[model samples]
Target: MLILGAFNLFVGRLYLIPSESMEPTLNGCAGCDGDRIFVNKLAYLGDSSPHPGDVVVFRGPDSWNGSYTSQRSRNDVIRGIQNAASVVGIIAPDENTLVKRVVATGGQTVQCRAGDPGIMVNGKKVDDEFTEKPMSNPVDPATGSQACQGPYFGPVTVPQDNLWVMGDNRTNSLDSRGHMGDELQGTVPVENVVGRVEAIVLPFGRTGFVDNPDIQHN
Candidate 1:
C-alpha cells in the first residue's frame, strides 16, 4: 500500500453497507442490489459545519474505547469484528460511530411524538416525507430497531454544543432519542460529530452525494 501516499485516494476507506438505519436513503448491503458510497473524511476539515440529512461517518464513543482498538482482551478481539460492523451501520453501536441525520443543531428546539409522524422544530411542523415507518431488516442488532413502531418524541432544546440526530428508518434506530444519561440526555457533544455525508459511490445508478428535501417547507 504505497505511492505518494496522499491519503489513499483510489482505495478510499471502503464501507460495506450493513444496516437498514438509513434505508430508502442509503442501502445497507454492500452489494445487496444497491449502491456504494464514499466517505470523504476531509469534507469537514476546514471551518465548516454539517447540515440536515447529510449522511456521515464518525468515530463513535467508549462503546469501543481501549478494548476494541487495543491489543487487550478476548472481548477486544470480538469488539474488533463488531466495531467494523458498527462502522457500516451493521452493528448497533454498543461501541461505534454512527451515520445519521443532523436534525437539530446547536441552538434549535426540536420535538416529536409517537402519534404523529411529523417533527416539530421550534414550534413549527417538519412533516418529512423522507421519514418513514419502522422497516424490518435483520442486518442491525440494536434493540430499538426490533421493538419500535415509531414517530418518536420530546420537546427539548438542542444543547449549547450538542447535536440531535435521528435515523431515516425511524423504527430501527436508537439515536438521540435513546442517547440519554440524566443530564446528558438528548444531546451528543458537538465535537463528537465528525462530518456530513457527501455522496454515494456504489450501486451504479445511485452514485453521488446523498440528497434530501430542504429542512424547511414553503
Candidate 2:
C-alpha cells in the first residue's frame, strides 16, 4: 500500500475530467461528464518536451483559467484539503490547471484557416480525426462577440521551449488560439506541463489508451 501510494504521488497520477472542452476525446462536454484518466507523470522527466498531438495537463497562466469551474467556491480550508487530495490523485486539481493537446512546439508556425478543417503546423495541415469537432476561431463567451469575423488567425510562431495547445472540441475550447495577444502569443512554456495523459482507466466502457494523432511535420 505504501509503495502504491508513493508511486501515485511521484510517478503516475489520476485526474478526473471536469468539462466538455475536450468533448468526445475526453468526455467532459455538456450532458456528459469527463472521464477518469491516468497521467504518466514521468513521461517527460528528463530534458524532453511534449510532442505535437500529445495530450497534456498543465498549469494555466494568469491570463487563462482551467477547462471548467468548480461547482462552488470553497473556503480556504476546503481548498487546501482539495489541493492535498489532488496531489495524490484522489481528485482532479480544480485550480489553475488545464488539459489540452499539443498542436505545435518550439520553432513551428501554427495557424487556423477560416474554412479549413484543422490548423496547420509548420505549413502542414493537420486534420485530426480524433478531434470531436472541426477547428474554428474562438469567440468571447461573455459577450457573444467574435474576435474576428472569420475564424482565421495568423501563422504565429511558437517560441523556444514552448507549446501551442488546443482542445479536441475546438469550437468550445479556449485554447492557445484564444490567447494570441498574450505575452507568449498563447504558447505555453514546456515547464508548466504536468504530464501526458496516457489512458482512460475508469468507466469500463470508455477505458482505453488515448490515441496520439500523427501531427508531425518534417
Candidate 3:
C-alpha cells in the first residue's frame, strides 16, 4: 500500500507559478515577478471545463517551443533541484510547463488591435477586467518577439481544437499572436491543458486562490 501511495505521489505533481504569462490571477510572479502557484495534477479527471481567463498549466507539445528557453530559473535554487529531469523533459521542464491565460478555447476568434482598447471575441470586446493590460501587441515573425518593436497583426481567428493563449503583460508577452499562431511555435491545443492554476502558495505576499473570474469566451 505504501508503494501505491508513493507511486500516486509521483504520478501527480504540484508546481509553482514562476513567470508572468498569467497575471492578475495565480500571481505567476507577483508584481510580474516571483514563483507561486500550486496545481492539482489530477484535476482533469472528470469532464472539466477550461474557461477563458483561467490560469492554466499544461505540457506543451514536443514541438511547441519557447524562445527564452531555460532548463532552470535563475531566481530559485529549488527550480534547479525540482527540474533535475531536464535532459528527458520530465522533472526539469526541458522547456515544457507553461502558465498562460485561456483567451479562447475550442471554436472562437480572438482579436486585439493597437488603439482598439480591448480584446474582441467573435467581434465583441472581451471583458478586460482582470487583465493587467489589453491584448494588443504585435509580433515580428522574423525575430519571434513583440518587445523588439511592433506594428504587427490583426483579426486572428483561433482555430478549432486549439486554445488561444496570451500573457497578461501585453507589451512584453509572447502568446497566440506571436507568429500567426506559429505552428509548433505558438497556440496551445486543448489536449495539452492539464488543469487550471488555482493559487499562489509561496512568498507570503502572493499566496491564495487565483482571481481572474471575469473571463467570458464566445
The 0-to-1 C-alpha lDDT of every candidate, in the order given, reads: 0.60, 0.77, 0.61
Over 1-218, each residue of candidate 3 has an lDDT whose tens digit, in order, gives: 45534443433344656666555554454455565566555555567667777777777655556454765567577676655443222343444677777877767766655544467677676766665544445555553333222333456666666787776766556666665645633567777876676667777776677765656743
Best by TM-score: 2
Q: Point to the candidate with the largest lDDT.
A: 2
Under the 3 Å rule for N, CA and C atoms, how many clashes does model 1 have? 12
Query: Higher TM-score: candidate 1 or 2?
Result: 2
Give candidate 3 misplaced runs (Cα > 4 Å). 1-12, 26-33, 66-95, 133-152, 212-214
Cα lDDT tens digits for candidate 1, 1-218? 24412333322344545667777787774446644556665655657666555566665544313334433237877878876554454434443556777777777887765443466677666645675543554423332222233534577788776677777877766677765543546566667765556678776787876774557552
Clashes of each: 12, 3, 2
Ranking of candidates on TM-score, top first: 2, 3, 1
lDDT of 2 by residue, 55-160 (tens): 9999887678634467424788887877666666676656677899998899999876554444777767775667664344455544332322225777899999
Give the range where candidate 2 is weakest over 10 consecutive residues by summed lDDT. 141-150
TM-score of 2: 0.81
**C-alpha lDDT of candidate 1 relative to the true structure:** 0.60
Ranking by lDDT: 2, 3, 1
**What C-alpha RMSD separates each model from the true structure?**
7.1, 4.6, 6.6
